[model samples]
Target: MAAPPTDSFTEFQTNLTQTKAQSTTTNGNTVSRGPSPNRGASVPDNEAIGPESTTQQKWLTEHGIDKSKWVKLKRLNHMRYQHEDLNVITTFLKDFGVKVVKKTETERWYAGYGPDQYVYYARQGPRKFLGGVFEVDSREDLEKLVRDHADTLQTKGIEEMTTAPGGGSIVTILDPEGFPVNFVHGQSQRAPQQMPEKLVVNDESTKPRARQFQRFSPGPAAVHKLGHFGLVSAKFDVLREWYTTHFNIVPSDMLYIDLPNGGRKEVAMFAHLDLGQDLVDHHSLFLATLTPDSSIPEPHVHHCSFEVHDFDTQALGHQWLAEKGYQNVWGVGRHILGSQIFDYWWDTSKFMVEHYADGDLVNEDTAVGYGPAGHEGLAVWGPDVPQEFLH
Candidate 1:
């Protein structure tokens, strides 16, 4: 949308350098514990692990990701809203496949999709937002986690849990970085009653001869679940440290950027992390490098992505966005690591969004790679960077 502010990188570098130097002596004494069966937790580490590229991927895979089983990312529910017009906000998400299913008189709405996580959006009069919900396995699991979190947070009374659309329950908590997060259990089917009615996009050019099946159809909405979120912050180290400390997330890879193609400004490399097995997608969250003069706003969401079932869905998304007058930032490229093919675009508000297909799956043994901060690294499968995207 709005070209991220200029100098975003500069501010990131300056703050990071200071963060590295401003060490807290209290870090070593902290104890590590898993999430309470009821409450959510934060990552425990602040600094990046050694650049032992070869085993990072394998290490992650061993933890729990079955790339082949990953159907599609649904939706990440955001409580924070920058708008007051409920219609405008709901309209935008609905156009992109999110639907408002239920709500309270206070303007809080629960949006659900057959394929993705249910999102809860509540209007806090204009700017205030609340915690979000992530779809999980069952209501019992949700209650247990919420109850555990309350214990960890040491809330004296047991907290009541919320119900979700797909026959599941939800637990809300504040992450180590002070971000509100909710976990959901059990999903109730709400759309596309018939198997024949399901519209699936196919990425494969040909079907296996031995496996003869009927052609598939397209479904109502392409996005099935919430994928991941990227956040921008001036307090890089503080947020980074906070996340790792509270959650079990670990740094799978890290990057440092040097701008202008040859300057010693050494402060521009963006920091990246993977949330491991407790979450979905390659990275549940990404923190870009920031500078005071940087184009992006401080502590802002860089972009959020939705997963498409196949190449057909991905292509349809690209066409839809183009016809609707949106910016197609980057696309149709496969990543070397996550291996998912993706296309990027901006909404009317300039918030960056991605519709991706076939992302690469990583396991404990997958090798991690690094390169200078540039477009070439972002998309391992696309044609050379489009000049327009460089801007």
Candidate 2:
């Protein structure tokens, strides 16, 4: 592949326009736009790190896994955490755009403005990475998972999630690194909140709104849904295999670094839940391999991300967090792979959290891509990548 285009906002806009134009099609007398944009330009490559390769496809075929047997994960449901003080975490969550849906003496369920019943669940306890939650297609799907992997599943049987906002059945499985992975099914859906209207802009060539009155109050960016989360893992290969085999998650992109001998070793992966013909976010989960050269020695949750309204909402939220004295990580930029306008910050738990908007969506038809890993590979237009975020 040729070198990636230079990181510039102007180039991004131009490419976006070209992609939109290419996506339009006409049949008979009717014209319609495709569901996704052309993603060729989003693929990253680096001469310094070595040549890129789409090894994920070969790996999957070699495994000979049948898709019909894998558990169908619909989307990310919520993230669970254990905190010493619920009040502190609650305050932080509110500031981050989550509202308290239901609270008890021991547990609290916080929800965003989106359709999900809740986006985050916190309980009073010692700090612990309880793990992320995913929604499965049906109860039979969860049963099939237990029946097929009886030896590996952590929970003996499905547990009734009565305490949660949307009562459901849950089964927890432990990954190779002993992180809890919860799968839920039969949960009732919540009605979506009214989304803010998309703002109309007046460019030099075209002005849509005659009376322009756009005003925004400085506050938390209203979150739409849980987009994705990432983890730094020492046992990357093991966890990767476990996730890919158990669920219908496929790699959107892989990042590799040159090895000392000659070949390349994949160091990171950005994978999304595959719903076949259904379109979803580019990535619902990301995993970075921990190596000797890594800045952080231990395994940790890198970050959890939420989708917001749009560019203006993200900018105002970034300002809100800045004024609230939260430490910024890296963002206010567009990512090359996901094409999301992003802003990352350090939460009260010292874990990275992100607010993003205008992200690309794809289905199973999207091809997997490979790239080189580095600061430049992180974003196409943003402030210098922070050292703390890389690890």
Candidate 3:
């Protein structure tokens, strides 16, 4: 998908540097004050769910995110997972479109056509969440993370990731909810793999391919890169504060629910990196709040999403997986939030993975939005969202 133009970072930062904002809260709770259904309500302090400024320089300063204090992440590197049967999961992944990078009896490394050497890591054993791996902008950025949570239980010294492809230094930190989040530095890049030709299409407004016919082969939607992943949490507020405070993560949209006494609870947050003037995916992570009375005993992962080339590529990929008898989860629709055309399926291990295309992108200037939490608000159009997909 085409991304928005990114302004020159050097110039943008130079023009807008200032002290960061202090943490602000409402009644000692999170920032999801119930907005009027028709319009956004003012959040406590200036943390309202709206873009306070249009320029990246202005947005950064407003959010109190300066280069030195915030750990700047370059991109989502990969996701690591463990399954009871390596062979079973491997077969499913191949049909799902990733090329194996390196495989042993117990471990498998997978790659997409993107610069990342590996995008998904699988290991044999019981089902377990290994963590979402990220590539930080600099070694200093990694060190900044170390300094932020130095004495916490989540702290771990950096170590060489010798066994993984594109050996790099990595440090693992557990979020307050005890899920591992890895940060890496200095990994070798991989060359791009061959991709399907961009088929020219003629729409009602534009006739671009006058003499050509569009054709495609049935195949797995070959992944381009790891786009984003999601998590469900009972401690949504705590998790939100930790991530938004420590990293350059800021909200694109914050979904909430109103309480009996006219209070507000943040039920869901979709956030993106504050890359100053650079354009990036509308959201890199989605966190949904687990209601206290819900049957789920603990927080869990929602799914891992990958990017495919276009609509044709995604449709073909969807058919391929269905023919292979994989259980379909919720998707083949356009999400209202990021506007991604999404398709999700379950791996042999029961973990959800998605292939999406044509998603929205934003810079720091994009406004933070607020909406109600409901299945009806999920998609602009698609098959009904599965209840199984929720909890």
Candidate 4:
């Protein structure tokens, strides 16, 4: 197959550089632009880099998938899980910014301050990572998915979701690595909660308000929505292909590692749901390659992240968690890739969960970036990356 036109790639690089410029500027001073002159005056030389190549598009074409056939995923709806003790987990989730939406003797659904009914679903059972769930555009899309990937479809057809909140029809499918992915349709929408008022800022030149008043109170950070989640996969390539082919997910960025034979191999990916011109979070899902060299035993969910209101909310939330004596994984730093002010913690069940604010938003036109995969690559400014967090 022929390569995709280079025009898009060129435009993407130009836009990316401009975005970086805007982001790094503070109080009217621009940060160092790109690589320094002493460092060769070019893009940094690293195994990991941005997604300027037509590799992703070319891979799609090779697999006989085109833009039209790509599944239309609306957004990441919620995550499903099983816990040993519902009461303990529920208490932790409440403190973590989720409110109980609905509950029963065996199951419970918790929601953030968003329109969608829930952001998390849990059941009383053995601890297990059920999977991340997605809301699709239509029942037709779900039917088409079954037709195309019948081998992997766990449900024979669209099955009514009687137990979940805002009942919908769902079909579960297993990814190449056996992760259960459920696509839902016809779920009832809830009234969106009122958004917090934007705080007035006093800039160097312009002070928005005449009076400066302190804002913020001690409490759990109210999550606005589900932002993203990640998994460490041994078969990263296979999982990447499975997601991209079956859904309208695209790579926002990729991380590469140096090969013993020379050159580099793509290992970690930050991917987003593509909705054409509509903007969405920088990444709704993250995938990292784990091997014996990385000291990770097996593939598993790394963390599920939710978006809070702002930096102040995040800081307060971190404080709240710290005071409560929740185990900290890593955090209170900004990531270089997605530009989110992030903090992570271990839930009562020992699963990693994260609270992030001020994340980058991207549309289909955004460029996919490539970068080195390491603790340093993970954040621009933060405390040292924890060893447990890396694995």
Q: 1-391, model 4: which lDDT tens digit per residue? A: 1122233444545555554555366788776655422111122212123434445455456667677877899999999899999999999998899999899999999999888899999999999998998999999988987888789888878899888779999888888887888889999988868898888878679987787796778989988888888988989989988788778999888788888999999998899998878889989999988877554598889899999999888889999988888998998998877778999999998899999998777776566666667777788788999888887
Ranking by lDDT: 4, 2, 3, 1
Ten contiguous residues minimizing lDDT sum, candidate 4:
38-47
Candidate 3 lDDT score at position 69: 67
Residues 1-391, candidate 3: write the lDDT tens digits. 1122234443333333211122348899655433322211212212333332234354446656555666888888999999998888888988888989898888999998888898999988889998898889888877777777676525357778788889998878888887889889999998767776888878779998988877677889999999999988888888987887778788788888889999977789888887877988988988888866544558888899999999888999999999999999976888878888999998998899999998888876567777788889999778998877877
Model 1 global lDDT (CA atoms, 0 to 1): 0.49
Q: Name the lDDT value of residue 175 in candidate 3.
A: 88
Write candidate 2's Cα lDDT for 1-391 as tens digits.
Answer: 2224667544665666665565334574535454443343433322211334344456568767567768899999999889889998888888888899999999999999888999999999988778898999899988886787676687768989888888999998777777788899988989867988988998789999788888888999988899998988999888888788878988888888889899988888888998877888989999988767667798888888999999989898888888888889987999877888899988787777899998877766666778888878778788998778887
lDDT of 2 at 183: 92
Worst lDDT run of 10 residues, candidate 2, spans 42-51
The TM-score ranking, best first, is 2, 4, 3, 1
Which window of 10 residues has the lowest lDDT sum in candidate 3? 37-46
What is the overall TM-score of model 2 with all chains considered together? Answer: 0.84
lDDT of each: 0.49, 0.82, 0.80, 0.83
The better-scoring model by lDDT among 2 and 4 is 4
lDDT of 3 at 62: 67
Q: Which stretches of candidate 1 lie over 4 Å from their true place?
A: 1-82, 104-117, 120-124, 127-179, 182-221, 258-280, 365-371, 381-391
